[model samples]
Target: MSSLYGLRPLPSHGRFGYSAITRRPGYAWPNGARLAVYLGFNLEHFAFGEGLGARIGPASPEPDVLNYSWREYGNRVGAWRCLELFDQLALPTGCLLNTALYDHCPELVSAFAARGDELIGHGHTNAERQGDMPEAQELALLAGCHARIAQESGTAPRGWLSPWISESRTTPDLLAETGYDYTLNWAHDDQPLP
Candidate 1:
């Protein structure tokens, strides 16, 4: 084993373009301030039917559910509840969205857009996890996710988190190629890392 272990050198010069607004130092949460609360939804509740066949099949739970009402419930009840809370607090909230939500409830998607809320894609489907697929498949899936989310959400996704916290060896490169501005999958630092 080498004495250097796994340590790698970091750039010693030049500034990384960044800033903070409505914030103070030593907080450095983002934009130089502490985040009061970050609201995120896996957004997969829509695909509960396809992902969890029980939600739709004969083996379905005794919920007497509609064809695919999970997202509708999420948007109408869950999202709205969250929005109302934020409104009461006048707080800035973030949303973690999944691609499938667009298909399930376009109006809900529009609501988020209308509010100008922060959004980041969680993935195409709640259960179509990425970390287990082959590199090529992962990349293709990532590309498809980006396109679908943009088509439905009315904006190109700037970041991605993942369904079920899943990822493959190639997730990084694939995410980069998919035109993401950043990712929150491998968080392990006091500050955000690329």
Candidate 2:
């Protein structure tokens, strides 16, 4: 037992070691403003009769048409309306894109690209999660997403937000290898941390 049991420091983990924000160097944001804003608009697709999804009603056993159709509405109609609103407000957005949207309804994706919004990788689809995949499979998913976004959007995505904010142990390493410069998975604070 130590003299001050309650004051012992905990061991640090992860590649980013612990450091208090107050002790770190301070810098002003662009235009000398302390805040900046960007919208994270998610455009996703789901597999029918399988995997995970958000629901507007109680869970059905399987092949839930009500829920599936509800989600599909966002792609077919809702996203367009939202885009129009963004344009009216003259705001920039960062789309957390599911690559499946490229095949399912490319026009929707093209609309975002036309507005010069940033496309951030959000996997091939939201039906499954990257955290559940093995390392090799996760890497493949990351690489596939990078390539798809670059080909379809014309500008390659500089960041990623794992489907459902899910990731395997090697996600960071894999993201770097696949050319991602940032991630939205962690939001512990207003400022971006290493």
| Candidate 1 lDDT score at position 56 | 40
TM-score of 2: 0.91
Q: What tens digits encode model 1's per-residue C-alpha lDDT throughout 76-95?
A: 68877877786787766556
Query: What 10-residue stretch in candidate 2 is worst by lDDT?
Result: 6-15
Q: Please name the candidate that would achieve the greatest lDDT relative to the true structure.
A: 2
> In candidate 1, residue 9 scores what lDDT?
58
For 85-146, candidate 2 gives per-residue lDDT tens digits of 99999999999999999999999999999898999999999999999999989999999999
lDDT of model number 1: 0.67
TM-score of 1: 0.68
Per-prediction CA RMSD (Å): 7.3, 2.4
Clashes of 2: 0
Worst lDDT run of 10 residues, candidate 1, spans 12-21
